[model samples]
Target: MKATIPVYDICTVSDGHQHPDLLTERLGSYLKENYQRVHQQHGHSFYHLVLFTGGSGSHTLDFTRYAVEPWQLYFMTPGQVHSWHLGPETEGYVVHFSTAFFRSFLANPDYLDRFPFFSGQSPDQVMEVPEKLRDAIQSVFEQILQAGADNEPDLVRALLLQLFLETDRHIARDGEPGVPQQKQLVLRNFMALINRHYRSLRLPREYAEQLYITPNHLNALCQDLLGKTAGEIIRERVLLEAKRLLTNEQKTVAEIAGELNFPDNSYFSRFFRKYVGQSPEEFRKSLN
Candidate 1:
């Protein structure tokens, strides 16, 4: 058997929403209060901005592990599985907000697509805030907390907007500057489409069709930006979902394969072994 991954949702208590469209809390207090929920393999229904001020440890996103240290900020989009292990002395601020919250502030509904780090295709998930900007970032986070406390909705929204713009400046400064704007837009749209349809649309040609681009052009774009063909990108996404499903013991291998739209269980096993270096059963056993 394998451990189940929990998906957490937070809500703005002031207004009753099933899922939290927006929330911000100090890291130490939030972790201490929700101790059981803090250190676990879980996905969220919203985006996260975790600002660490002290202590150290490590965090794992999907299968990749990263150091958890002070002066660094971690951002996560909805549906990315992650877990963390931290020292007892760890302290920080954590902001949780949904795309809807951000959409209300901008004319564009998908403003996050314009931010490189928000696009899942980027390898950059954690960014280190420069020492000079540390104070400024902390101040903004404090204001957000204060606004939440005062129940000032407009102030909270404005503060969050300012925070996102400042963080965008940091991300742009650190990201690859030479990638052309048009290519970036294309790649971003392609990635968004994959996230939306990866479970059912396994073909690069299909994705290209949805994006209104030729398959060859999409392949070239993936190769240029991600050093992988469009097919590889699609396969990687399918493989990631496969791994996530394998952790759910309630779902049999055959059932998981069917849900992923594989032709058959045997074919799914072969594909899993080809990319993951292990059969479905073996992967589950190792986790056990």
Candidate 2:
């Protein structure tokens, strides 16, 4: 298979200019006169929060496609591959911000790891925004766009936080209720650790050890919250990266296996097939 999915940083789409720490724009305009690029699978170095206020379509993250409608919101974290196909009438607000912008807002480097929406543990990435709340969210996005013109980074940062806070409230209200906070914390920590060490560590026990929890405890937490064992969660992360590499990078299967720390190509092939339902080469070919 050819390398069809390229990982793009903000600069790559901005005429080779450096990406601003935070930026906002109308979704339709940002995609420009030709909107087909939005349908191409790609990865980003920045986080994306897109709110659609008109029309309908679908957005795919990893291998799952999500339905999108007016007044719906979607979040995409850095390193996740996503693509969209929205109707031509679609109108929305899009906010793009870097990791540095988020880190500057809070002392904790992993502050974003706590968000339930884009985190790997969450299955639902799209949230239905209440009609009453749309105006407020729109105002915040407009403020961020205007703040950019004034070159006020601090103002943009503050408004961005407000937007996120409001979105969080809506998500919490609409999401599954009565999930214990302790279970949420364990899942969050597990996702954070996976993001940090997915390439070298493939074992659930490794993550459990670092979190100072027993392996069984970690597995139980995952089973309760995500309906999967801790090891399955780890493999899910690994499989995501494996698919990304197979589709984006030019490396052969064996080389990719070695880079991902698999002992041999066969071992990697078996693991990939077990979770993804196809051999690595077959998966790559199917992408064509």
Question: What lDDT does the true structure give each of the candidates?
Answer: 0.78, 0.76
Model 2 lDDT on a 0 to 1 scale:
0.76
Which residue runs does candidate 1 get wrong by more than 4 Å? Answer: 1-3, 11-20, 98-108, 120-122, 172-175
lDDT of model 1, residue 14? 17
TM-score of each: 0.86, 0.88
Question: Largest TM-score belongs to which candidate?
Answer: 2
| Candidate whose lDDT is highest | 1
List CA RMSD, all candidates.
3.2, 2.6
Per-residue CA lDDT of model 1 for 190-237, tens digit only, reads: 887887788888888999988899999999998988899998988988
Q: How close is candidate 2 to the true structure, as a TM-score?
A: 0.88
RMSD in Å for candidate 2, one decimal? Answer: 2.6
